[model samples]
Target chain A: MIELTDVHKAFGSKRVLRGVNLTIPTGTSMVIIGGSGTGKSVTLKCILGLVTPDRGKITLDGQDVTKGDRDAFLARFGMLFQGAALFDSLSVWQNVAFRLQRGAARRPKAEAREIAIEKLRRVGLTPEVADLFPAELSGGMQKRVGLARAIAADPEIIFFDEPTTGLDPIMAGVINELIREIVTEMGATAMTITHDMTSVRAIADNVAMLHDGQIKWTGPVAEMDDSSDPYLDQFIHGRAEGPIAAVR
Target chain B: MSGATLALAPVAAIGRLAIFAVRGVSHVFRPPYYPREFGQALMQIGWYSLPVVALTALFTGGALALQIYAGGSRFNASSVVPSIVAIGMVRELGPVLGGLMVAARVASSIAAEIGTMKVTEQIDALVTLSTNPMKYLVAPRLLAAVIVVPALVAVGDSIGIWGGYLVGVYHLDFNAVDYLKNTVNYLESWDVVSGLIKGAVFGFIVALAGCYHGMQSGRGAQGVGRATKSAVQAAAVAILATDFLLTALFFTS
Candidate 1:
């Protein structure tokens, strides 16, 4: 489980996160939905320790992660970045096995490559695609490779940032299904940030809506459509009016 | 403007710069030394930069020979050409000029490459993988450049001295053996040592400036361009400053 209490973050005069509190229980997929720049990414970064909160208590599995051992803490989680952020210089397999080869696990090169190929197969990419660089692969393929890499070291937790952005609907669905299967198969606790309703429906076990630097609504995915909150209704229905302004 | 406001600007900028430098230095000693990356930086900084550094050194050596001949002729003693050229190339010209040339090449490449990685979010990806971007990306390049640049300076010294020898033996109508003998006689251990030391320091400056400016880069193409330019400028300035300081410390006449 991951917990954040009274997390606050500001960049200069702009308060991005305002005393946000949330809890993510073990073995659950919580998808946080929000408009861009509403501190969704900041929240994720704070948990990853990429960004520091002004005053907050963050704990992982009941251990205070606020000032916890960073490497030891990070070793437990894997991440799939928003842009798929693959290294241009590395071949697809090398990128996937980056952690295995250079990871704290300290596996040898040949072993790392074999595991990378295995994970790529898990993500529906063939061994031949492994030799090609990120620039040579299509967007969908790149995401699969990114996903393969995230699970390479078999981390206990995984964070997915916009897993379906910029993909065609069919491609998005395929990725969503793959994410769902992988989460369950690995039994890893997953947190994904996305605004895609289809992705949220396909992958989320629990849904959280971020608004005005706080979580406005959260519930089981099944109850999301029937929520009584006006903000949730306005957001999901894609309506512009009725207590939810397009801009604030 | 108020003195307080004016002072605050430099202070803030310095603070940011210091943070950047400290992070870069810490990365230099840490683990996950990327071998391929270190090899690539070596080729870029030391090998690929040879043509430009060689040309600069050659021209400077030939020019120095001409100047020495002119000065010696005034004293009715033009035999000092080879000896003067050898000393000048090894002690000052080889390391400093070669360093500046590499500053133009290595610093800009590192800055642009790392800056693009920053804009593209690859650095963040490294972080999520439990890898420190500073240690993974910056350390190997810095280490490789520092090791290889002294070898580069040694090569530059040989080439520069040859350039001077060509000028003195052919253009200045001096005997070839006399020129060679004078050059061989004038060469000293301290002169060669000084040049190698300068090379190591200059290499560090190049890598440091490159990584620093790259991390400080903002978003988009304009940010990359600015980072590249800053990398080169900072490297050149650091090289010249260190050259003067090292020269003073090593060989004060």
Candidate 2:
């Protein structure tokens, strides 16, 4: 389980996250939905220790994440970034098996490549694609490659940031289904941030709506449509005018 | 901005760069060295830069010989061309010009590549993969620059003196044997050593400036362009400034 309490963060005079408190139970898929620039990424980065909160307590499995061995802490989590974030200099398989190539998780090169190929296959890519660079792949293929890399380590936790942002609707659905299946099969605690309603319906077990740097509404997916919160309703229905202003 | 803020800005920037340099240098001695990356950097910074350094030194040396011959002729001392050319090439021009050439080529390339990586969030991805950017990216380049640059300067110095020899012996109708003898007799071991030391320092400046601006680059294409520009400018300035200081330290009475 991952828990964040009273997390507050600011950049210069602009306040981003203010008193954000949330918890994800073990083996659950929690999708955070929000408009652009609402601190969703910042919140996720804070948990990953990529960004430090001004004042907060983040505990992973009852251990304070900020005060432990970083490598050991990071070993338990995998993240798929918004832009895929694949290293252009490295081949696809090398990117997937990056973790296994160094440090405490170091493995033999051949074994790492084998595992990379397997993960690539799991994400609907062929073994032939492993030798290609990220730039050679199409946008959809790159997302699949990113997904393959995220699950390559079989991490206990996985983060998906805007997973289906730029994909066509069909490709988005395919990615959403893949994400849902991976989360269910691996039983890994998943935290995804996306505004795609289809993705939310397909992948989210629970939905949390973030507005104005705070969680405005959070409930199980089954109850999300029934929630009467005006902000949540306006956001989910894609209305321009609401209590939550369209422009910041 | 106020005058005080303007004055303090450079101080603050220097402080930040100092801190970044210390961090990068500290990682150089730490474990988990990436030999493959270091080898790649060596090739990029040293081997690939040879042609430019060689060409620049050749022209500078040839031009220096002609100018010195012209000036010395006014005093009926045209025989001093080979000796003056050799000393000038070994003592100053070799390291300074070689360093500036590298600053123009290698520094800008480093900044652009790393800045693009940062913009794409690959640096953050490296962190997530349990790799330190300082170790994997910055240290190898720093090591390569510091090690390979002096060798480049030595090559530049030799090529420069050879350029002068060509100009003096063939173009100016001087005896080849006499010109070579003058060059060999006038050049001192300290002159070469001092230039090599300056080469090492200039190399460090180039790599550090590139890596620093890259890591600090903001998002987008414009940010990368700015970073690349700033890195080359900073490196060129730093090399020239350090050259002056090193020259003062080495040659002043």
Candidate 3:
């Protein structure tokens, strides 16, 4: 389980996150949905320790995420970034096997490559893609590669940041299905942030609506449609005239 | 944009650079060192920079010989060309010019590459993979620059002297034997060693400026372009300034 308690983050004079509190139960997928720049990414970064909150507590399995060994803490979590964030200098397999080939989880080169290939296969990429660089792959392929790298180490927790943001609808659906299937098969606790309604419905076990730097509503994905909150309704239906100003 | 903010900006920039350099240097001695990265940096900073450094030194050396001969003739001391060219190349021109050339080449490349990585979130990805960017990126480049740049300076000095010898023997109507002997006799080992030391310091500055500016890059193509520009500018200025300081220290007596 992951818990964020009263998290607040301000960059210079801009308050990005204002007292955000949420929880994800074990072995479940929780997707955070919000408008652009409403602190969805900041919330994810705060949990990953990439961005420190001004005053908050982030705990993983009841242990404070900020107080422990960073490497050990990071080893338990895998993340697929919004842009895929693949290393341009590395070949596809090398990128996937990056964690396996270094640090405390070091594996022999051949074994790491084998595992990378297996993970690529799991993500529907072939062995032929292993030697190619990230630049050689299409955007959708790159996303798959990123997903392969994320699950390469079989982490206990996984994060997907705007997983289907730039893909075509068909590609986005494919990625959404992959994320849902992978999270189920791995039985990893998943936290995903996306504005895509299709991705939210496909990948989330529960949905948390983040608006004005706070969670306005939280419940099972099934309850999202009938939830009485205007904020949730306005966001889900993509209405422009409600409480959320489209201009900002 | 405020006057007070503008006034304090340079001080803040210097403070940030100092902190970044210290952190980068500190990572060099830590464990989990990446030998592959170190080897790649060696090739990039040292081997790949050879052609440009060699060509620049050669042209400067030939030009110096001609200028020294012209100036020496005014005092009826035209024969001093070879000795002056050798001493000048070994003591100052070789390292300073070579450092500046490398500052333009390698520093810009480093800054742009690292800046792109930072913007792409590759640096953050490295962190997520349990790898420290300083250790995997900055330290290797720093160590490689320190180790390889002295060799480049030495090679530049030798090539520069050869260029002067060619100009003196062929263009200036000087006897080859005498020119070689004068250069060999007048040049001391300390001159060469001092310039090599300058090369090492310049190398450190180049890599430090590159990595520091790159990590501090803001976002997008404009940010990377600015970082590259800052890196080359900072490195060239630092190399020249450090050259002056090192020269004063070495030859003041």
Q: Each candidate's chain B TM-score?
A: 0.93, 0.98, 0.98
- First chain TM-score in every candidate? 0.97, 0.99, 0.99
Full-model lDDT for every candidate = 0.89, 0.94, 0.94
Listed in order, the DockQ scores are: 0.69, 0.87, 0.85
Q: After superposition, how far is residue A22 of candidate 1 from its true place, in Å?
A: 1.4
lDDT of 1 by residue, B50-148 (tens): 888888888888999999999999988788888889999999999999899888989999999999999988998888787888788788777877888
Give the DockQ-based CAPRI class for model 2: high
* TM-scores, all models, native as reference: 0.94, 0.98, 0.98
Candidate 3's error at B36, in angstroms?
A: 0.8
Q: Residue B49 in model 3: shift from native, Å?
A: 0.9
DockQ ranking, best first:
2, 3, 1
lDDT of 3 at B58: 95
- Tens digits of per-residue lDDT for model 3 on B60-163? 99999999999999999999998899999988999999899889999999999999999989998898888999999999999999999888988998899999
Cα lDDT tens digits for candidate 3, A151-180: 999999999999998899999999999999
Error of 1 at A25 (Å): 1.3
- The DockQ-based CAPRI class assigned to model 3 is high
Model 1, span A193-247: residue lDDT tens: 9989999999999998887788889899999999988888888888888666787
